[model samples]
Target: MDRATWDRVQVLLGQFVYRSHQMRYAGELIHCGHCGSPITGETKTKKNKKTGGDKQYVYYRCARYNDEDHPRIRMTEAEIDEQILALFDRMRVEDEEFRNTFREQLRRATNWDLGTETKNED
Candidate 1:
Protein backbone atom coordinates (compact mmCIF):
# COMPACT_ATOMS: atom_id res chain seq x y z
CA MET A 1 0.00 0.00 0.00
CA ASP A 2 0.95 3.63 -0.52
CA ARG A 3 2.33 5.69 2.37
CA ALA A 4 -0.80 7.79 2.75
CA THR A 5 -3.08 4.80 2.62
CA TRP A 6 -0.97 2.94 5.16
CA ASP A 7 -1.07 5.89 7.52
CA ARG A 8 -4.83 6.13 7.17
CA VAL A 9 -5.21 2.43 7.90
CA GLN A 10 -3.07 2.78 11.02
CA VAL A 11 -5.14 5.68 12.26
CA LEU A 12 -8.37 3.79 11.68
CA LEU A 13 -7.01 0.76 13.48
CA GLY A 14 -5.95 2.88 16.43
CA GLN A 15 -9.40 4.46 16.65
CA PHE A 16 -11.02 1.04 16.54
CA VAL A 17 -8.81 -0.20 19.36
CA TYR A 18 -9.53 2.87 21.43
CA ARG A 19 -13.27 2.50 21.00
CA SER A 20 -13.06 -1.17 21.89
CA HIS A 21 -11.76 -0.13 25.28
CA GLN A 22 -13.39 3.26 25.72
CA MET A 23 -13.25 3.38 29.53
CA ARG A 24 -10.69 6.09 30.33
CA TYR A 25 -10.42 5.87 34.13
CA ALA A 26 -12.15 2.62 34.96
CA GLY A 27 -9.22 0.36 35.68
CA GLU A 28 -6.35 0.98 38.10
CA LEU A 29 -6.34 4.75 37.67
CA ILE A 30 -9.17 5.42 40.07
CA HIS A 31 -10.71 3.53 43.00
CA CYS A 32 -13.68 4.10 45.19
CA GLY A 33 -12.84 5.75 48.47
CA HIS A 34 -15.87 4.31 50.19
CA CYS A 35 -15.96 0.71 48.99
CA GLY A 36 -12.41 0.20 47.81
CA SER A 37 -13.73 -0.93 44.45
CA PRO A 38 -12.38 0.23 41.13
CA ILE A 39 -14.20 3.19 39.67
CA THR A 40 -15.99 2.61 36.36
CA GLY A 41 -16.67 5.04 33.56
CA GLU A 42 -19.87 5.30 31.61
CA THR A 43 -21.28 7.55 28.92
CA LYS A 44 -24.78 8.99 29.25
CA THR A 45 -26.69 10.58 26.43
CA LYS A 46 -29.18 13.34 27.07
CA LYS A 47 -31.50 14.77 24.49
CA ASN A 48 -31.72 18.53 24.21
CA LYS A 49 -35.36 19.62 23.98
CA LYS A 50 -34.77 22.78 21.97
CA THR A 51 -32.30 21.51 19.40
CA GLY A 52 -33.25 17.82 19.42
CA GLY A 53 -29.58 16.98 19.66
CA ASP A 54 -28.06 14.36 21.87
CA LYS A 55 -25.36 15.43 24.30
CA GLN A 56 -23.10 12.79 25.67
CA TYR A 57 -21.55 13.05 29.13
CA VAL A 58 -18.95 10.81 30.69
CA TYR A 59 -19.23 9.87 34.33
CA TYR A 60 -17.11 7.99 36.82
CA ARG A 61 -18.52 6.12 39.75
CA CYS A 62 -17.68 3.33 42.09
CA ALA A 63 -18.31 -0.10 40.72
CA ARG A 64 -20.18 -0.92 43.90
CA TYR A 65 -22.37 2.13 43.74
CA ASN A 66 -25.43 -0.01 43.25
CA ASP A 67 -24.65 -2.15 46.23
CA GLU A 68 -26.78 -1.79 49.33
CA ASP A 69 -24.34 0.14 51.49
CA HIS A 70 -22.39 2.01 48.83
CA PRO A 71 -22.90 5.72 48.40
CA ARG A 72 -24.96 6.55 45.38
CA ILE A 73 -22.66 9.20 44.07
CA ARG A 74 -21.55 9.63 40.50
CA MET A 75 -19.01 12.20 39.46
CA THR A 76 -18.87 13.69 35.99
CA GLU A 77 -15.62 13.58 34.11
CA ALA A 78 -15.40 17.35 34.47
CA GLU A 79 -15.74 17.05 38.21
CA ILE A 80 -13.00 14.47 38.35
CA ASP A 81 -10.82 16.70 36.19
CA GLU A 82 -11.39 19.65 38.50
CA GLN A 83 -10.57 17.59 41.57
CA ILE A 84 -7.39 16.33 39.91
CA LEU A 85 -6.35 19.85 39.01
CA ALA A 86 -7.00 21.02 42.54
CA LEU A 87 -4.96 18.15 43.93
CA PHE A 88 -2.08 19.03 41.62
CA ASP A 89 -2.34 22.65 42.72
CA ARG A 90 -2.15 21.60 46.34
CA MET A 91 0.83 19.32 45.60
CA ARG A 92 2.87 21.98 43.82
CA VAL A 93 6.22 22.71 45.47
CA GLU A 94 6.67 26.44 45.94
CA ASP A 95 9.15 26.43 48.84
CA GLU A 96 12.51 27.97 48.08
CA GLU A 97 14.16 25.51 50.46
CA PHE A 98 12.90 22.53 48.48
CA ARG A 99 14.07 24.09 45.25
CA ASN A 100 17.53 24.64 46.70
CA THR A 101 17.73 21.07 47.94
CA PHE A 102 16.73 19.70 44.54
CA ARG A 103 19.29 21.88 42.83
CA GLU A 104 21.97 20.66 45.20
CA GLN A 105 21.08 17.02 44.54
CA LEU A 106 21.20 17.58 40.78
CA ARG A 107 24.58 19.32 41.08
CA ARG A 108 25.96 16.47 43.17
CA ALA A 109 24.75 13.89 40.65
CA THR A 110 26.35 15.77 37.78
CA ASN A 111 29.62 16.14 39.68
CA TRP A 112 29.63 12.44 40.56
CA ASP A 113 29.15 11.47 36.91
CA LEU A 114 32.01 13.78 35.87
CA GLY A 115 34.27 12.36 38.56
CA THR A 116 33.52 8.80 37.45
CA GLU A 117 34.31 9.64 33.83
CA THR A 118 37.64 11.31 34.77
CA LYS A 119 38.65 8.33 36.87
CA ASN A 120 37.84 5.94 34.00
CA GLU A 121 40.08 7.98 31.66
CA ASP A 122 43.12 7.45 33.93
Candidate 2:
Protein backbone atom coordinates (compact mmCIF):
# COMPACT_ATOMS: atom_id res chain seq x y z
CA MET A 1 0.00 0.00 0.00
CA ASP A 2 1.06 3.61 -0.52
CA ARG A 3 2.15 5.68 2.46
CA ALA A 4 -0.98 7.83 2.50
CA THR A 5 -3.26 4.79 2.27
CA TRP A 6 -1.27 3.02 4.98
CA ASP A 7 -1.56 6.03 7.26
CA ARG A 8 -5.31 6.20 6.68
CA VAL A 9 -5.64 2.50 7.44
CA GLN A 10 -3.70 2.97 10.66
CA VAL A 11 -5.94 5.82 11.73
CA LEU A 12 -9.07 3.83 11.00
CA LEU A 13 -7.68 0.82 12.83
CA GLY A 14 -6.83 2.97 15.84
CA GLN A 15 -10.34 4.44 15.94
CA PHE A 16 -11.89 1.01 15.63
CA VAL A 17 -9.76 -0.34 18.46
CA TYR A 18 -10.54 2.62 20.67
CA ARG A 19 -14.29 2.28 20.05
CA SER A 20 -14.12 -1.45 20.71
CA HIS A 21 -12.34 -0.82 24.00
CA GLN A 22 -14.85 1.81 24.99
CA MET A 23 -17.75 -0.52 24.20
CA ARG A 24 -16.20 -3.30 26.25
CA TYR A 25 -15.40 -1.16 29.30
CA ALA A 26 -18.06 1.56 28.98
CA GLY A 27 -19.91 0.36 32.08
CA GLU A 28 -17.17 1.72 34.35
CA LEU A 29 -17.25 5.28 33.02
CA ILE A 30 -19.87 6.64 35.39
CA HIS A 31 -22.47 5.51 37.91
CA CYS A 32 -25.44 6.98 39.65
CA GLY A 33 -24.41 8.25 43.07
CA HIS A 34 -27.76 7.45 44.66
CA CYS A 35 -28.94 4.06 43.35
CA GLY A 36 -25.64 2.62 42.18
CA SER A 37 -26.95 2.33 38.64
CA PRO A 38 -24.94 2.96 35.51
CA ILE A 39 -24.73 6.38 33.93
CA THR A 40 -23.95 7.29 30.32
CA GLY A 41 -22.41 10.38 28.89
CA GLU A 42 -24.02 12.18 25.97
CA THR A 43 -22.97 15.15 23.94
CA LYS A 44 -24.78 17.84 21.99
CA THR A 45 -23.40 20.38 19.55
CA LYS A 46 -24.69 23.83 18.72
CA LYS A 47 -23.49 26.89 16.93
CA ASN A 48 -22.20 29.88 18.82
CA LYS A 49 -24.24 33.00 18.15
CA LYS A 50 -21.40 35.47 18.58
CA THR A 51 -18.60 33.54 16.93
CA GLY A 52 -20.67 31.47 14.45
CA GLY A 53 -18.79 28.35 15.46
CA ASP A 54 -19.76 24.93 16.64
CA LYS A 55 -19.62 24.21 20.36
CA GLN A 56 -20.10 20.85 21.97
CA TYR A 57 -21.72 20.18 25.29
CA VAL A 58 -21.38 17.00 27.35
CA TYR A 59 -23.38 15.55 30.20
CA TYR A 60 -23.72 12.33 32.13
CA ARG A 61 -27.23 11.10 32.79
CA CYS A 62 -28.51 8.09 34.65
CA ALA A 63 -29.45 5.11 32.49
CA ARG A 64 -32.17 3.91 34.81
CA TYR A 65 -34.53 6.80 34.31
CA ASN A 66 -37.29 4.50 33.07
CA ASP A 67 -37.36 2.67 36.37
CA GLU A 68 -39.99 3.94 38.79
CA ASP A 69 -38.00 3.78 41.99
CA HIS A 70 -34.59 5.13 40.96
CA PRO A 71 -34.18 8.84 41.23
CA ARG A 72 -32.88 10.68 38.20
CA ILE A 73 -29.32 11.94 38.16
CA ARG A 74 -27.70 14.29 35.69
CA MET A 75 -24.39 16.11 35.72
CA THR A 76 -23.11 18.69 33.26
CA GLU A 77 -19.58 18.64 31.89
CA ALA A 78 -18.97 22.06 33.42
CA GLU A 79 -19.95 20.73 36.83
CA ILE A 80 -17.59 17.80 36.45
CA ASP A 81 -14.83 20.13 35.29
CA GLU A 82 -15.43 22.38 38.27
CA GLN A 83 -15.21 19.44 40.65
CA ILE A 84 -11.99 18.32 39.01
CA LEU A 85 -10.55 21.84 39.32
CA ALA A 86 -11.55 21.92 42.97
CA LEU A 87 -9.83 18.59 43.47
CA PHE A 88 -6.61 19.91 41.87
CA ASP A 89 -6.89 23.07 43.89
CA ARG A 90 -6.98 21.08 47.11
CA MET A 91 -3.97 18.97 46.13
CA ARG A 92 -0.74 19.55 48.10
CA VAL A 93 2.70 18.05 48.06
CA GLU A 94 5.54 18.07 50.60
CA ASP A 95 8.12 19.14 48.00
CA GLU A 96 8.36 22.89 47.43
CA GLU A 97 9.25 22.53 43.74
CA PHE A 98 6.32 20.23 43.10
CA ARG A 99 4.00 22.65 44.86
CA ASN A 100 5.24 25.56 42.76
CA THR A 101 4.83 23.53 39.58
CA PHE A 102 1.32 22.53 40.57
CA ARG A 103 0.43 26.14 41.37
CA GLU A 104 1.75 27.32 38.03
CA GLN A 105 -0.24 24.67 36.21
CA LEU A 106 -3.39 25.64 38.09
CA ARG A 107 -2.88 29.31 37.25
CA ARG A 108 -2.32 28.48 33.61
CA ALA A 109 -5.36 26.24 33.42
CA THR A 110 -7.57 28.91 34.96
CA ASN A 111 -6.07 31.77 32.91
CA TRP A 112 -5.06 33.53 36.09
CA ASP A 113 -1.91 35.49 36.86
CA LEU A 114 -0.72 37.02 40.12
CA GLY A 115 0.48 40.12 38.27
CA THR A 116 -2.92 40.67 36.70
CA GLU A 117 -4.67 40.28 40.03
CA THR A 118 -2.29 42.72 41.67
CA LYS A 119 -2.79 45.26 38.91
CA ASN A 120 -6.54 44.85 39.05
CA GLU A 121 -6.56 45.37 42.80
CA ASP A 122 -4.55 48.59 42.63
Candidate 3:
Protein backbone atom coordinates (compact mmCIF):
# COMPACT_ATOMS: atom_id res chain seq x y z
CA MET A 1 0.00 0.00 0.00
CA ASP A 2 1.03 3.58 -0.53
CA ARG A 3 2.28 5.72 2.35
CA ALA A 4 -0.94 7.75 2.44
CA THR A 5 -3.12 4.67 2.65
CA TRP A 6 -0.90 3.21 5.30
CA ASP A 7 -1.08 6.42 7.28
CA ARG A 8 -4.87 6.35 7.16
CA VAL A 9 -4.82 2.75 8.29
CA GLN A 10 -2.70 3.71 11.25
CA VAL A 11 -5.18 6.37 12.28
CA LEU A 12 -8.13 3.99 12.10
CA LEU A 13 -6.22 1.28 13.94
CA GLY A 14 -5.32 3.70 16.67
CA GLN A 15 -8.97 4.64 17.07
CA PHE A 16 -9.87 0.99 17.09
CA VAL A 17 -7.48 0.36 19.94
CA TYR A 18 -8.85 3.25 21.94
CA ARG A 19 -12.50 2.45 21.34
CA SER A 20 -11.92 -1.21 22.09
CA HIS A 21 -10.19 -0.57 25.38
CA GLN A 22 -12.47 2.21 26.57
CA MET A 23 -15.85 1.46 25.00
CA ARG A 24 -16.05 -2.25 24.44
CA TYR A 25 -13.40 -4.49 25.92
CA ALA A 26 -11.58 -2.98 28.85
CA GLY A 27 -8.06 -3.96 29.82
CA GLU A 28 -8.19 -6.61 27.14
CA LEU A 29 -6.36 -4.81 24.38
CA ILE A 30 -4.78 -7.38 22.16
CA HIS A 31 -3.91 -8.67 18.73
CA CYS A 32 -5.87 -8.93 15.54
CA GLY A 33 -9.58 -9.45 16.04
CA HIS A 34 -9.65 -12.38 13.66
CA CYS A 35 -6.78 -14.44 15.11
CA GLY A 36 -6.26 -12.93 18.56
CA SER A 37 -2.53 -12.62 18.02
CA PRO A 38 -0.16 -9.72 18.20
CA ILE A 39 0.54 -7.65 15.13
CA THR A 40 4.30 -7.44 14.74
CA GLY A 41 5.69 -4.19 13.46
CA GLU A 42 4.13 -2.73 10.29
CA THR A 43 4.10 -5.88 8.25
CA LYS A 44 0.83 -6.40 6.48
CA THR A 45 0.73 -10.20 6.58
CA LYS A 46 0.98 -12.75 9.35
CA LYS A 47 1.02 -16.51 9.40
CA ASN A 48 -2.30 -17.08 11.07
CA LYS A 49 -3.05 -20.24 12.98
CA LYS A 50 -6.76 -20.08 12.80
CA THR A 51 -9.00 -21.84 15.30
CA GLY A 52 -12.68 -22.79 15.42
CA GLY A 53 -14.70 -24.45 12.71
CA ASP A 54 -16.89 -23.18 9.92
CA LYS A 55 -18.24 -19.76 10.80
CA GLN A 56 -16.59 -19.63 14.22
CA TYR A 57 -12.94 -19.00 13.53
CA VAL A 58 -10.22 -17.65 15.81
CA TYR A 59 -6.74 -16.97 14.50
CA TYR A 60 -3.66 -17.55 16.64
CA ARG A 61 -0.20 -19.07 16.64
CA CYS A 62 2.09 -20.72 19.15
CA ALA A 63 5.81 -20.22 19.76
CA ARG A 64 6.69 -23.21 17.66
CA TYR A 65 5.11 -21.75 14.57
CA ASN A 66 7.10 -18.52 14.46
CA ASP A 67 10.39 -19.65 16.02
CA GLU A 68 9.78 -17.01 18.66
CA ASP A 69 8.52 -17.21 22.18
CA HIS A 70 5.54 -15.09 21.34
CA PRO A 71 3.71 -17.02 18.68
CA ARG A 72 0.91 -14.82 17.45
CA ILE A 73 -1.71 -15.45 14.82
CA ARG A 74 -1.17 -13.25 11.80
CA MET A 75 -3.48 -10.85 10.04
CA THR A 76 -3.01 -7.57 8.24
CA GLU A 77 -3.37 -4.41 10.29
CA ALA A 78 -5.66 -3.05 7.59
CA GLU A 79 -7.89 -6.12 7.82
CA ILE A 80 -8.21 -5.91 11.57
CA ASP A 81 -8.86 -2.20 11.49
CA GLU A 82 -11.57 -2.73 8.92
CA GLN A 83 -13.31 -5.11 11.30
CA ILE A 84 -13.19 -2.47 14.01
CA LEU A 85 -14.67 0.10 11.67
CA ALA A 86 -17.50 -2.25 10.82
CA LEU A 87 -18.24 -2.58 14.50
CA PHE A 88 -18.11 1.15 14.96
CA ASP A 89 -20.50 1.68 12.08
CA ARG A 90 -22.99 -0.75 13.56
CA MET A 91 -22.80 0.85 16.98
CA ARG A 92 -23.21 4.31 15.49
CA VAL A 93 -26.64 3.27 14.18
CA GLU A 94 -27.74 1.67 17.41
CA ASP A 95 -30.11 3.26 19.92
CA GLU A 96 -29.16 6.81 20.89
CA GLU A 97 -29.93 6.18 24.55
CA PHE A 98 -27.79 3.10 24.49
CA ARG A 99 -24.90 5.05 23.10
CA ASN A 100 -25.22 7.77 25.72
CA THR A 101 -25.47 5.29 28.54
CA PHE A 102 -22.51 3.43 27.15
CA ARG A 103 -20.44 6.57 27.11
CA GLU A 104 -21.53 7.41 30.65
CA GLN A 105 -20.53 3.97 31.83
CA LEU A 106 -17.18 4.41 30.16
CA ARG A 107 -16.66 7.66 32.02
CA ARG A 108 -17.67 6.29 35.40
CA ALA A 109 -15.73 3.10 34.92
CA THR A 110 -12.54 4.90 33.95
CA ASN A 111 -11.96 6.41 37.38
CA TRP A 112 -10.42 3.70 39.49
CA ASP A 113 -11.65 3.41 43.09
CA LEU A 114 -9.68 0.24 43.89
CA GLY A 115 -12.82 -1.87 43.50
CA THR A 116 -12.72 -2.24 39.76
CA GLU A 117 -11.62 -5.55 38.32
CA THR A 118 -10.11 -5.78 34.89
CA LYS A 119 -12.33 -7.48 32.35
CA ASN A 120 -9.87 -10.29 31.64
CA GLU A 121 -7.76 -10.54 34.78
CA ASP A 122 -10.58 -11.13 37.16
TM-scores for every candidate against the unseen true structure: 0.55, 0.46, 0.26
Error of 2 at 50 (Å): 7.2
TM-score of 2: 0.46
lDDT comparing candidate 3 with the true structure: 0.36
lDDT of 1 by residue, 1-122 (tens): 35543443343334322231245456656779987888888776667588998755566788888998788898754355345434434554689788566445534433442342212110
* TM-score, candidate number 1: 0.55
Candidates' lDDT values, in order? 0.54, 0.48, 0.36
TM-score-sorted candidate list, best first: 1, 2, 3
For TM-score, the strongest prediction is: 1
Model 3 residue 57 distance off true place after TM-score fit, in angstroms: 25
By lDDT, the better pick of 2 and 3 is 2
* lDDT of each residue in 1-122, candidate 2, tens digit only: 35543443343334222221122213445457777777676655667689998755455667786688876655553344345456555767789898777556544543332222111110
Whole-structure CA lDDT of model 2: 0.48
Candidate 2: regions farther than 4 A off:
1-27, 45-55, 69-71, 110-122
Ranking, lDDT, top scorer first: 1, 2, 3
Q: Model 3, which residues run further than 4 Å from truth?
A: 1-10, 13-29, 32-38, 42-73, 93-122
Alpha-carbon error at 73 in model 3, in Å? Answer: 4.1
